[model samples]
Target chain A: MSDKEEREISRIKEVESTNLARDDIRELVIETKKAVEKDNDLLANKIHRSFLDNNIKSFDIVGAIGAGKTALLEKIAEKLTAKFRMLVICGDITTRVDADRIEKYNAETIQINTGRECALNAYHIHQIIKNKDLQNYDVIFIENVGNLICPSEFVLGTDKRIIVVSITEGEWVVEKHPMLFKMSDIAVINKIDLKERLGTNVEKMIADAKNINPEIEVITTSAKTGENIDKLLELMGF
Target chain B: MKEELTKIEEIIANPNEIKISNIQELMEALFAKLKNRVDNYIGDYPTFIEPVYLEENVKIGDDVLLGPNVYIGANSEIPNYVEISNTIIFDNVKIGENFKLENCIVAKNSSFNFKNLNMKNSVLIGAANLKTELQNIGF
Candidate 1:
């Protein structure tokens, strides 16, 4: 017999030796198919129409862990709470730490524990707004789970999608996760206060992001030191 | 000191006069002493349900069932029809209606209001003020 046929026979034999059943494999396949078949554009359009109907501006913030996403949101919430009615939906694998921190700024907050999900999808946002009175807020911010890879694949239906990356994550972060930058409307290079100490070339990182999508708006800020936060708000048309 | 020594040569040769028969005997004695110390340390180790301690101000509503390895801290409120198993709840927690929790840790000052939700092997930290009508949600 052919070598490939022999290998396939051995693989089938190995599967038969294990306790894994055919029904388990079938269920996994069905679940995976459903997840892969989710339509992003349709959900995005629905979310956009919902926001337009309610006269609310929404933004989705995505980033890797320790990328200063929550810090940036906290800074923005603090600066804008006086003028705008804001609501924050913090998405995490577990814990409501970000939502609790944002609550100090006196904005209404909802914490969505995604459990094992890596990224927050449009369905999550839809569920949050399905029953609530959307007209109660002027702006909504959905802070996606701390991830750079999976969040790019799921569009959570927002007016603007911002990806935050820190200079401390090394120089190659933008280059490594180029898909996130390409899908994002704006890229925020955070933690500029440590730029000199870490010897990170911020200009090069910005150039890499621009290379992915030349039309993307790039803003640099240090959330800790409150640098260029007003400029970021201005870019968002606040 | 001479009586303490098993051999006169040991007392003469060793200045400290702490004589052992050999290195093997000394190791066995050391290990035996350590085992005894550890056993004594763990003699009063409490089981899951034995010697349960509940704070005076803790409020437990009707029809609440707590399984093994469950600890409810001070001022925590377990409302009606809630079941908890293998869970550790800290102070000031307020659990609302008809929720099932297993192998979970609920942090301090958190409040949850949901029905028919099952959470297992989850660690919920910080304050949560949630109100939802959950159905068949398992985590």
Candidate 2:
């Protein structure tokens, strides 16, 4: 064979090998991500089982911004503080405002700043629980970051997952975010006091949530007026 | 208040602490102590513009007022006439005009187009188009 032909063939082979190596690296990255997610789920489940063994009930409350999750939590903490010892873990992209608010109710609160992450994974909860004495509190409430879409994908090993949606978010919010309802154990339609002002159809929204997840218990609440808060506490077995 | 009173009573009952007969005097001392503690805590809070951490390629438009304790992440755009106070705006966020944001955490890649809207103590995720006023004024 000629020297020129051999050199061209070798260069072609080198280019093909480089392309193959790039493809392999991409696949490895994707596989690694999936494996990490699986490990997170396993760790979350183990933590949840540990809590159950200790007879502690934990809840993960998730919702969008301005959906009244923090307000609902404040009401719950205020009502339940007299009877039960509770801990609140407030998750946000940044800032500890929610934790500071919950602390005003005399509950031990921890703030998990997820930085740029939209959801609170099981790993974050695991880190917090591993350091703290979990037996001190009978109930733990994890207020996930103010997001509807991302929190549904990450299960933080809670006994109950509550999705709070308000009338101010528009009537189609439930229909738009069905996965949150499907993953949640209870769906709270908050801000019932603004129903008249917003002209929202609360019943239809609840129906839509139920259609997505039939087993989800739907409740209407007005955190401002303190309506149905007692019923919510009762349902939570406070 | 009840909890505080209980703590004060416990303190009064202790032999190691100073004994006070009048409840009013004890309460006044406790109030002063609380005020001092609160003042110290407030002093620790980050002042606006003191801890302003901006990352790479952040674009701030004309007439934007950034208040204290604000952190603007990488590649975020702050347009004209926006007042942000005690807020953390994450990376790749596109903020529009005439918006007042206080005590907010705006997540990454969120877009906002609003005018004269006051958003306080809120977390904005994804895309938000806030239109507060109706276009047509009824004659």
Candidate 3:
């Protein structure tokens, strides 16, 4: 067998080991065929090849508005670079604002301008990574638009979704937007340094979050003061 | 977090019916859905929701009184007592309390207050008071 064929076989085995059902494999094969027909052959290969890569760590950073997500993203980017080949797919309404903001990090950053589009769907993400070589990177970070509602509905085909919540926002944020909190794979409690100043009850906030999602992985950090950043990185598998 | 997201799995498994006869019809249906939500606004509301479309499983919060003739071109939720009137709310809104909104699309906890708000092609978060004067516009 050719190197590519062997790689494909190995990838499929890995996915099977992860408890993917027969129907899942069938759907993937069909999707791969459609992608090959419409997008290109290269993407078809990547989709199939993703099954083989043992270290394709993909995660997302989502949050409500003014939740200190941007600041926290920069700090994470700075730290994640030490151990992984990290890339950031920044989302915005009009232009590349977030992409421009994180330009100093020396990482691959692309601004997926949704224009009038509200959120990023799986097809859109497939289009974004189709032409790029993700083999060089160990991790991909998606800084989703600072909107809680839309991002919750769509899946970007990532391994995990990390929700960034700030102290200044509110304890009711998670309860109000249960979808975002519920969909998250990890919850980052940002801006802890201002917890006392903002009169936020930290334990209460965590408790409220936990009530919404019993299995949520929580990490508290201060993007401003750099508190518990190590814990955040550790959770991210960086 | 994975455990909490199980509800989404059910929604994704059993989605609301979608009928996009054509792209234009889809757009119109989206606008119609959004226009129905103008009664819930709470800040410097803008008119950015007039240009997009959404799928299903969207939710909003209270005190979202929509502004006059506002159009939201997507699927969304408007919770109880969120004051919004005569404004166009966009898709994917999770707004909260004491929001005086009008003439705009309130995005993702983006606030609005005051009267005659003109939010066009801009996203606002916790923004307040956007006064605009257009005689033709009414709640």
Candidate 4:
């Protein structure tokens, strides 16, 4: 082989050995750049190529139990369906009943009864979607088993990892789980309508969240009243 | 007959064990057992094993390493240099080249589609789940 081919081969081998190497990130940025200079949107193309290339686009909505994630997800799912074929994966440890609630949307839904484990791992999530005809839908919403800690550790092949926080969950929550916010592409503040009664400082919350993840997009909404729902939908790439 | 014999052995092994109050719990136990068996089987399953297991309709590329308990349904075209271990890939799906997947799926590409987690069309770098939503919602 020529010198160039040898170098490429050796680079691939090195990449394979250190799967978490920064070179992969560098390559991703380079591809994004190429797609950009060619008069095309790299992010959009990457989003679409993500399907053709990786075959996985999983995202999880994580928050504390009272963050109103279920209602927020219901609202988001409604908007998500208008632009993209959507499936709502409801997670609970005991019942298949959660799937029933989301089935009315007429989208495929899966109930991951994690049993004793609070979090759903990548392996189990993979098993659940292996037989899905992916061309049928555009987005998949994984409503993680409601907990702040365990679900953060597993990667389920999502295109984006999002965190859902309600204003009432308190200010310290942002400072507490810096890594979860670091991993998320977006952070959603739900139940904004309750900000007054709950004394939630939106500015403080946003500031704290941004301090943890500078580039993270934060959307405030009230699923109960459908306030700022459209903006949330738009941010979700609807 | 062998399957039937094992069934009988399980019956005899636990005569009064059918009263579990939780179906999910029971399934979890069964799944764990199956996963353990798959883990051990991969260590000893034949290296010459075929990529397409059914009687017909399977296409696979060269230098692919497929481990035990891997299920590739009919009409699935998995391209070259893909490593699938303990995965269930469905039919009529086109898996790209140089993909490394273990305990994962080309889900959404399957017939038994559900709302479970989908890792399709995305690459995961190093990340961890966090305990709070405030970690990254601002700015």
Top candidate (DockQ): 4
> What TM-scores do the predictions have?
0.58, 0.59, 0.51, 0.50
Residue A159 displacement (Å), model 1: 0.4
DockQ for every prediction shown: 0.01, 0.02, 0.01, 0.03
On a 0 to 1 TM-score scale, where does candidate 3 land against the true structure?
0.51
Lowest lDDT block of 10, candidate 4 chain A = A39-48
| TM value for model 2 | 0.59
Q: Which stretches of candidate 1 lie over 4 Å from their true place?
A: A1-37, B1-139
Name the best candidate (by TM-score).
Answer: 2
Q: Which CAPRI category fits model 2?
A: incorrect
Clashes of each: 0, 3, 57, 25
> Positional deviation of A229 in candidate 1, in angstroms?
0.2
Winner of 1 and 4 under lDDT:
1
How well is each residue in A1-238 modelled by candidate 4, as lDDT tens digits? 9999999999999878787666668888878766544433333344345455644455678877778777877776666655567776666654545556566655566555444467655544544455456677667778887888877666555677788888878877788888788888888888889888888788887888899999999888898999988887677665
Off by over 4 Å in 2: A1-24, B1-139
Task: Sort candidate 3 into its docking category.
Answer: incorrect
Candidate 1 C-alpha lDDT tens digits along B52-83: 23444667655454433355667988776676
CA lDDT of A112 in candidate 3? Answer: 56
How far off is each candidate at the interface, as Cα RMSD in Å? 17.2, 11.0, 12.0, 13.0
lDDT of 4: 0.57
Off by over 4 Å in 3: A1-54, B1-139
Query: Among these predicted structures, which one has the highest lDDT?
Result: 2
Q: What range of 10 consecutive residues in model 2 chain A has the weakest lDDT sum?
A: A108-117
